[model samples]
Target: MKAAPPKATFAICGVTLLSFALLSATDRFADAAVLGGFIPARLSGLAVPYALPVWLTPLSATLLHGGLLHLGFNLLMLYFCGRDDEVALGRPGVVLLYVLGAYGAAAAHYAVGPHSTSPMVGASGAISALVGAYAILYGQRRPSKFSPEVARWLHIARLAAAWIAVQLMLGLVSRTQGLAIAWAAHVGGFLVGLIIARPLLRWRYRKA
Candidate 1:
């Protein structure tokens, strides 16, 4: 008989890409917070195919980041928060979460800072959304940390929720004084990821 297909892991390529992105960001921003200097830039949503104009830094800045400290934490978060979604949603679902989460983040940042040069670059926006969806899916279940069942990871659910609420609230309140927090991106990405992940989760729970 043919073997069953392998299940997906949390974070998946998001973690890896984030890892390398952090490395690049670190190499470039070791001295100062050079936001969008590194990482992938989107040219024109559909024009660049997947990259942005370097001059349009702060616009899609979250796509970039700096330092292992930043990257490591983000990737780690993605791993934990991303698991349930990946396991339940499958690899393709994971990809959808990442992509949609990215769009959510980028959309928020772009809308907030259409004319700013702050440069929003990082995986937090996307990861936060994955965390959001994961939290919503399994927030009330699991052990709130480690679970013997791979399908019921709890620690991630808690952290993801906390992170999303904290970031969004902070960014919104702080933005009034010209202080940006990328909260919009977090909220937008998370909501999008959560919506996209819903059906995938349902599909995974079907009885044989």
Candidate 2:
């Protein structure tokens, strides 16, 4: 029998599509982002924005993207990694990992850029979590398609360093252009995924 589709993957994609459509179809993009995007100051009670509640922003913000490239990149990563996770870890487990990653990302962004007023939005942070999970799941082999096998930890470390360096460069460029990029959030999400992936995998598979 054809198995049922992965719920987490479909749900995430649906929400992202709906968000992009609604936000782009009207003039409410900025307003929606402001209302839904994570603002650490608001969440931490250091400041409050009247437009939206602080607690929900972290999750809501995951549904947002800065542009088509941003959305496409996140969706591609989510499709590849999220489906694999759902198959390996079960629907609930994958969803929980994603949510936890989002929260972790928010926490890190809050820590590093607490005073900034710009709202942080996008699924890269959560997607980075999936990348981390992927690393843990398949780290025994060489990560890059073009490379030979290496030590698992070394592969993960190299990938993490490269990810951080690229994100930092992009963040710097964006900031210089009056844009904000929550690259720190990406690091946090990746860490969360890396830390939890093995335990989650063992727990899920051991029972199956």
TM-score for each model: 0.60, 0.85
Cα-based RMSD of candidate 2? 3.5
Those runs of model 1 whose alpha carbons end farther than 4 Å from true positions after fitting are 1-26, 29-63, 142-161, 165-180, 202-208
For candidate 2, write residues 1-208 as lDDT tens digits. Answer: 6655788888888899898988888857777777888877675565545656777788889987767666776788788888878877778888888999998999899889888778898887887788788877777653454444457777788777876676566566556535577888999999988999888889887856
Which candidate should be chosen as best, given lDDT against the real structure?
2
Candidate 2, residue 14: the lDDT equals 83
Q: Report lDDT (Cα) of residue 101, candidate 2.
A: 91
Please write out the lDDT profile of model 1 over residues 14-40, one tens digit for every residue: 545654666565664422234333222
- Point out where model 2 deviates above 4 Å: 1-4, 44-50, 142-150, 165-178
RMSD to truth, every model: 8.0, 3.5
